[model samples]
Target: MIKLIGVALIAAGFALRVNTLLVVLAAGLATGFAAGFSLNEIMAMIGKYFTDNRAMTLPIVLMLPVVGLLERYGLKERAEVLIRRSKAATAGRVILLYTAVRQISISLGVSIGGHAGAVRPLVAPMAEAAARGRGGELSAASVVSIRAHAAAGENIGNFFGEDIFIAVGAILLMKGFFEAQGMNVSVWAMALWGIPTAFIAFAAMWWRCQMLDRRIERTAADNAKAGGVQ
Candidate 1:
């Protein structure tokens, strides 16, 4: 039971708003001590786990520099310019389109699109530009709202779409969990069930996107009125 002190530490640390890395490290150390592990043993265990999972962090390490260079070279500006060329583009439509593309691509097991690689540098900027095209200056609140919706599209698309791929980790995890409970659940069945779930998720997000468009329009109208009053 003392080994569970780590869980309590994590909850307390997060509730207190401590630095995440420090909180995790402190929890790990406390847990290791409670479990009767030597400091050296705990350090070795941490090193081994990090080495085993290094592949997960490699993408972030490689992607950040490239993304930074692109942004420095006007990636967001280019995306904005491209989106503005389409007269029919609205902030919601831009997000909805990306959501579709993200869902379809991930369902096929193509691990494309992420908040860091796609949303920040491309989708959010494009959506903001589309909002500006609606014929009024956007308030800071409106810009933040558009960016939040862009992030929501990426998150919803990724979370629901990955389960549709039979080889994805989530499907295999579900299969293993059910088998452990003495229930026979096939990966294919899980993937098949995910189809309806993905469709429902897409439909829900589409409705939210429509609401986002109306919100953008209302913000624009309010800003226009405020300008007239000035």
Candidate 2:
């Protein structure tokens, strides 16, 4: 339907790699107009919503500049250099450590970084350098695998860890849901239970990381064998 033009625009914008903020704004305006809102009414609604949600948006808006400043100052390079100098920093260990960092920071209600804001720019690069340490260049497949693990580490850490923060949305949502179902559940209890789950999740990921290390080694060996045969 023509009413879905806004959705189409959003999809196309993303597919075409347009400016994200502009794409969002355009989608909003188009949707509002398609739904019979006048220009002034839509403008007023946008202004009011923006004012009300500024707190949530502020961090994301400010994050770009801060991340940009750090990148400009060689944060990625510094991370690589530090890890490369550490002989014990294997690819799996590096990712596990990053997962630990992510979980700890998120549990404390501090969001350090994410895949978009951190992984691609910082974590992946540091991991690549660490994994490549004293081993010459890695195969393309090996490099992709390391980056994938870096991204997964961020996801596992943040999702599990944030539930441990008492005031986070998950605790509040669970509390509300339980109350709605005529059951009593306290936020503290919910947070306490989250700790065990987070711990278990961390342990599972740790085991997986160790497995990943073995897999990478096997891949490297096979690649070397193939090259030698050639």
- Highest-scoring model, lDDT: 1
Q: List the RMSD of every prediction in angstroms.
A: 5.2, 5.9
Q: Which segments of candidate 1 are over 4 A away from where they belong?
A: 1-6, 13-88, 179-183, 228-230
Worst 10 residues of 1 by lDDT: 51-60
lDDT of 2: 0.81
If scored against the real structure, what TM-score would every candidate get? 0.68, 0.63
lDDT of each: 0.83, 0.81
True-vs-predicted CA distance for residue 28, candidate 2, Å: 18
Tell me the lDDT of model 1 at 116. 86
Clashing pairs in 2: none
Top candidate by TM-score: 1
